[model samples]
Target chain A: MAGPKYVLEVENVHRIYESAAGYTHAIRGVTLRVPRGEFLCIMGPSGSGKSTLMNILGGLDRPTAGVYKLEGVSTSELDDDELAELRARRLGFVFQRYNLLPRATVLRNVMMPLIYTNVPVAERELRAYKALRVVGLPEEYYDHRSNELSGGQMQRVAIARALVNDPALILADEPTGALDSATSELVMELFAKLSEQGKTIVVITHDPDTSSWGDRTVHIRDGRLFTEEEERALIEAAMRSGADINARRGHT
Target chain B: MRPGDLAQETWSALSANKGRSALTILGIVIGIGAVITMTSIIGGISNSMAGMFGANAARVLTINLHGISNFTLDDVAELAKNIPDVEYTMPKAQIQHEATYEKTKVQATIHGEVNKVFEAHGYKLLQGSGFTEEDEKRGSREIILDQYSVRNLFGNTDAAVVGKSLKIGNDEYMIIGVADKVNTFSMTQYDSQSIEGIVPITTAITRLTGNPNITSIEAMTSATSDADAVAAQTKEYLSRRYKLQDSKEEGATRTVSVESNKQLMQQVTSMTSSFQAIMVTVSGISLLVGGIGIMNMMLTNVTERIREIGLRKALGAKRFDITSQFILESICLCLTGGFIGVVLGLLGSFALCGIVGAGLAAAVTGSADPVLPVIDPGAILNAVLTCVITGLIFGWYPARRAAKLDPVESLNHQ
Candidate 1:
């Protein structure tokens, strides 16, 4: 599973939300580690803490109790600026809704993250175009607005935006949750291609078929790690066991 | 963001909502236009008045006796001769005389004045000659009529009446010349009687007229630059020489009234200034309202562009950059409004001037003709500055709110 080295190590991570009403514990202690260039899927039901964990890993949220290290820099110890720097340099994100700016063209949407970097506009545009080209969108589609694109095309633009910064890790949340089966296959194929290019990817999804796109699948229920397995064996077992008898069901 | 980019962005945003932007700017346009137009019109009126009074009319002084007292012509002559700065002192004997030119009779003011009085004042001989020293010495039958009098008697021809004989009462006199029209400053006292004719003091002494006592002495001085001061000094000297007392404080009073046209002009100017100030203030309110409109619109824009802000922030825009962008956009809006307002206001002022009868070319210093809008750089600067400040003051809150947004929350927003 390892090529270069471990890129992320998470140990005993816990997160709690406090309000006037009371405290809601979003994540219990959880531990995991991933080697470089591995495609790992975290499968969970709604409210099973996968999103919170993803947010922490992406440097968008802080864990209440945890030790998180990316290349030996402690995530919990960094300030806002440092966390932003980490996100900017190390992580790329793909949200479920695509999140393409309504007013911007596909190229401009891809260049959005590059605005935070010290990249010149020319270089940024070049990189954005390259990223879009990787997602199979032609140069002519670069000037097309987000609203003008189909659901799959919009998702692809979002993907191009995620990859434009050339981050070390990609975090995708329900990447094909909104797509039809055929479009979902196309997106999965894109993920498989990205993984083949040695880009480390983590996708959080409830669908086992989507999880099958990963090299390895990790299951979580009730804010606890349930199991981990090779993707091929997980898919084979899911097919034989039938959807109703799957252990991951009704656990969240 | 770079300033150029900011400007381009602002322009695009404004262009996108042309109707709203145009309407907002219209408020500013009307305000600036009104201010400039009103000021130009008032200025034009004042200038015309000044010109009508003669270029040096602003310096003319008039002296009068306070009340009916025993002040003699001898005393008046003595004062005129004794004053070191006095250029010409003439006794004014007012009398009503009827002129009969072939039984077409016209009533006129027969002013008895000294020989040199016409020249010392701004009188120009339109034809022939003025009263001579011989006429003052012998009290002969010679007179000078104003242009209007000549026009009325001879039917608008200046050459027809000069050198002709006209009978006033029982005496026949040769009209030596026609005097230029008197420039009257008092708007209320404009009439034909104000411009009748002038005759030699000797002729008045021989003809049917008033008492030998001079009603008032008309004095002209070479101190045209300081006419007010010269008039004041002459009044003071005459007061002492004649033992004149202040009528308000004295048990007895004279009919003398000493005044300077220059002082009157000063009062008029001050009044005009106050009027102009009020107009400028009223117009300023529209500019202010326009600024507020820009602020409100920008705030709305900020709210609508929250996702864009989040995207920008995520892309590496600093808080200051976002704030500057919004503020610049607002200023652009307001300045655009100001420029339109100024142009319209000028046009309005010119339109108003055309409606009024005053000569259009009179240059009023601080005021413009109602028909010609005056463009003052100071006003434009003030307006633009107001707009920029409005942008800052009003844009700050929204910009801060945008800058403070949680990037993740914003991105997650549906």
Candidate 2:
């Protein structure tokens, strides 16, 4: 059988959470596809279900009523441990807080993923060093504890950690949410550079400026995806209704 | 994850909170230490009690006749011949008298016995030979002085009192031999100023006391026979021969007392073992409490490291991986405490033995060897096994909780 043409495929996925109070439809019907080596950004407001989508895409969770495939393998069929294995070998995640072990050295943090993958000890350090070099982290800072580094340096270490495993897709959630604008620009530039190198990247964020770095941006509202043109139309229509209200207020 | 990696992770996690880890194992240390100390001391006491007699002490019995008895050497030989299990029998008698050797004088309890008494009591002849049967037959005034009596009448035990004349109750007897002090198990240590000596039964009867009566007979049972049974048979034979009655009614005066070494040993062994059992139960309670402490600390560790557990899971750690890591940590803690407890207990037992020995020397016996604690390898092995089992029992629930955590929720935990 031929391998999958797209790195990720999600069709009509739905997510529902049940609690003592009632049921919550976090995701209704969402479909998405990203071809190999494509940089896609999924943008949404708070509570807009972007995180839920990211969780499904990263195989951290299973879709309730959809077939989500990664590299031609359906993830919904995999058990918890198999999903964890998929995450370990096929996906890399970067969080907004730069979730590095606080007291561990930067090099150690970068090598953490390989430890779980049963990688050889000798190659782990070499791959971590290569990842660090690619992310432009200074060699002197490799031995320092992650908490001792600046915000930007810590994020760089996290990106190195994500890149060390060489996953098929890099999923970063608000990669620059904690950094200043200048440091954010530097991080986005690094992601752009990784994209230019034919590395498939998906960045989930609310900031338009952050999303602008991606090759394509998709907006989500009420658990539904919208293209750029459709999002513009929705914004213009909402503005038109507000203008009509102002005109009536003037007459009153 | 690889075993090396797992071990490294456990190390770092435990070392991160060194003070808490040390405090957590304190209960285990005390628990194991108490068990080790109690077993050592109790075991030592039991061993020394057995050591009080020679290794084959259970093979000997003593028969004492009282109240105008007419027991004689001929009767002892007759009893030895009649009793099926009796191997041999010797006559014994004791008399207190003042003894002197040229300006040195001492009070002594002189035993009238043959060489068999020295053999049965583990007495070593340090200087000279024992008296022969010829001397006993001739009723010669020859005596053998022990080291204590030798020291008392000759001013020092180093001087050979052999071939010298020693006045006893106005009769000067020739000293034929000098024997080492008999091991009475410190029974006579309190009588510091007194001495003891041995003489032929014939001489003691004809010369010293002017009596031809015997009072005590020491008998050794055959190796295959029980000492207690032999003693009973000996008593029955003597009772039948002498027409003795056990009742203390009017005019019933003759009685025989037969005691076996096995009987005395049985009583002492039962008492010591029961004491040991009670003490072990008390220590077991402490061990239980230690296990509970381990469980409490493990639970806290799981709660504190929720985010870490999440990250590891996301990095491909399975439930088994997480569980083993925590379990190994718990085992390490317990094993460390167990080993240290064993060392401390051994040291404590040694110190206690020294103190006991010193107290005995100063307040009771002048000198006796300290009771050495038995270092049982089986007990140490059991202690180690207990630690591991404790770790598994107490670490299971907490480790399960950690492994069962949802990665998403745990990663989002603040």
C-alpha RMSD of candidate 1? 6.4
Angstrom error at residue B237, model 2: 8.0
Off by over 4 Å in 1: A1-15, A18-20, A28-40, A50-93, A114-124, A165-171, A191-202, A215-252, B42-181, B186-249, B252-266, B356-372
Model 1: per-residue Cα lDDT at residue B47: 60
Instruction: Enumerate clash totals for all models, in the order shown.
Output: 31, 0
Q: What residue runs in model 2 are displaced by over 4 Å at the alpha carbon?
A: A243-252, B61-91, B95-108, B116-119, B123-187, B193-260, B360-367
Q: Cα deviation in Å at residue B247, candidate 1?
A: 6.1
Write the residue-wise lDDT of candidate 2 on A1-252 in tens digits: 235889999899999888999988888788899998889999989888999888888888888898999988899999988988888888888889998888688999999989888999999999999999999998999999899999999999999998999898899999999999999999999999999998889999999999999999999876778788877766776587765422332232
lDDT of candidates 1 onward, in order: 0.72, 0.83
DockQ of the two-chain complex in candidate 2:
0.57
The TM-score of the first chain in every model comes to 0.88, 0.94
- Over B236-258, each residue of candidate 1 has an lDDT whose tens digit, in order, gives 88777777776566576653566
Predictions' DockQ, in order: 0.24, 0.57
